[model samples]
Target: MKTIRQVSMLQFTLMVSAFQISVAFLSLPRELARQAGTDGWIAIFFGWGMATLASAALVKVMKNNPDGTILDLLQRYMGVWASKIAAFIFTAYYLLLAYDGFMIATLVIKLWLLPSTYIYVLVLLLLIPTFQIAQHGFQAIGRYSEIVTLLSIWIPFVYLSTLRHAHWLYLLPVIKEGWLPVLSTIKIMVYPMLGIGLVFFLYPYLVRKDKALRAMVISNTLTCLVYLGITLVCYVYFSPDEIAEYNEPVISIMKSIEFQFIERVEVLFIAFYLFVFSCIWIPSMHLVSMNSAWLLGKGPERGHLALWCFAVAVSFFIYRPSFIDAARVNNFLNLAGFVMEFALPACLLLYVAIIRKVRGEKRS
Candidate 1:
């Protein structure tokens, strides 16, 4: 079936925000502290600025063919053969993206919630809801994003409770070394802020295409605030040297909070985050299936979904990657996602501009 333009801007913004949150947020504080010390939070704003510009460029590319996906624009400006190649590359990227998210979620579950469960079993359980939502297409995906965002709204406030003994003095002397360190960490910020590029695929489905740029900016802003808030909280809550010691300072901070009514709130928090992290992979997996079907000259169907799901299940079951393995995948995604999310959009915008100019001149 043909896709429909039914996604509202609010749903789009929430979906984009969820995409940016990813597994990266879990260790974001450690990443910043290790790279830039206390001044690392500054890099988030810089990253947000860069992500916003990249998002704007993507919107402009979509504007060139407002009613079609990137695949359609590629075919129009490049050629059929070129579009297929581009689709294949995109398919690979999204597939890897899905795997990275899925693996991270499984790792977190094993570490905190389900240590004894088999990896393949967890993969299968995760895929069930993912397939159900994704098979229905982008509209269902958009609504799922909206629902998850609303449900997760209170999570940030829970973080605030960790600040009872926070040492505001820990954040003293901004840029302790120099701008060099803070500026250097901006590259580390790239991977987490990447969900904006989904605009390339999501633009055509936007109901208010005129406000696509606005939605992109707002979503990036929301993501930035979440990253910034949590990073700053971790910085003040833990010593600069101590922050990097914990792989996930956000979850570690929860250990400080004690309640008579509850034990191990961090465990509950991690379990709840299973649902939050689902936001990352489900949409990506759907995109994988969608692009795969497009390459085969078929509309999205359950067959493509089943094929990719089986592949993911089998691969993880065989590999059974350890924590180090998952980290390596994340590292690879950091580099690959930068190429796809940041570098490619800028190149495509320039190429599309030149192509349009030449075509206009030819018509004249």
Candidate 2:
């Protein structure tokens, strides 16, 4: 019997959007401020364009072989050895992405909400839910992402509240330093936009295969709007000089919002973010396991999922990394993502086009 492809286009799009809006979104305002000052929000548009182009290229690559994942394409067009290497690289990339999400969530939780909680305990807590979601495969992950996206709709509205005190003048003097800084900040926009790479594995599972590109574009558009809206709110709410001072200006600005019932909304906001943040590691862990299994020529076994969870937990325990270490890992992960997510698809598309043309000519 053939494996049924159960993920629908809507679920696939939500999964992509959820993956893009990750732990990085929390600190995005600060990074933008440091890189582009008040004009930082403009960079998101340029980032959106870049992300769209990359997604288009990725879509074309998948279109050439709609039934196969990247691993299958690589093995067919490249070779078994090359495909194995690609699989290994993908597994590592997904593992690092998962680890970064896990570490950042743990650190954020420990620092803001649970100061006394042991790191191992937090790691295991995070892993349990992730393992549960990932073991069920793409259908479950897509459904979970759709549910999380629907439930978390209130988050952006909460951010909208901070605009009451917004100083629109702060956004004035736009491009005060010319366009170079704003353009340069486009690079900083990449990490937060990294999650769209989920399409590499998910394209084969999409129910409406022809609409995959449209779904990806919609996903990137949603992500761009969210990032742009929040960054603009931050820019106007906080002074040019003050915005860069906070580690996470998006969360920090929430302190100004006052309500009768809730005393510390930011605390609750941070805690609830755990749900949004889980979207990252959960899908990421599944990607890691899926790619690793493909690398080993194995079926989708739940045993592989359990083993990876144990490995991740042991790695965290062995190192017991601090916030600084997590920051370093984030940096490395961003660099790897540029190559794996952004560059690799474009390269594959070029290779596939050329090879197909040559083969067609020989047949003629």
| Top candidate, metric lDDT | 1
Reference-based lDDT, each prediction: 0.87, 0.86
- The alpha-carbon lDDT assigned to residue 86 of candidate 1 equals 84
Give the per-residue Cα lDDT of candidate 2 at 291. 79
lDDT of 2 at 178: 100
* lDDT tens per residue, model 2, 83-161: 8998899888888888888888888888888999887789998899888889999999999988888888998888888
Candidate 1 deviates by what RMSD?
Answer: 1.7
Model 1 agreement with the true structure over 289-323: per-residue lDDT tens digits:
87888889875457898899999999988888787
Per-model TM-score, in order, reads 0.97, 0.97
**Which TM-score value belongs to model 1?**
0.97
lDDT of 1: 0.87
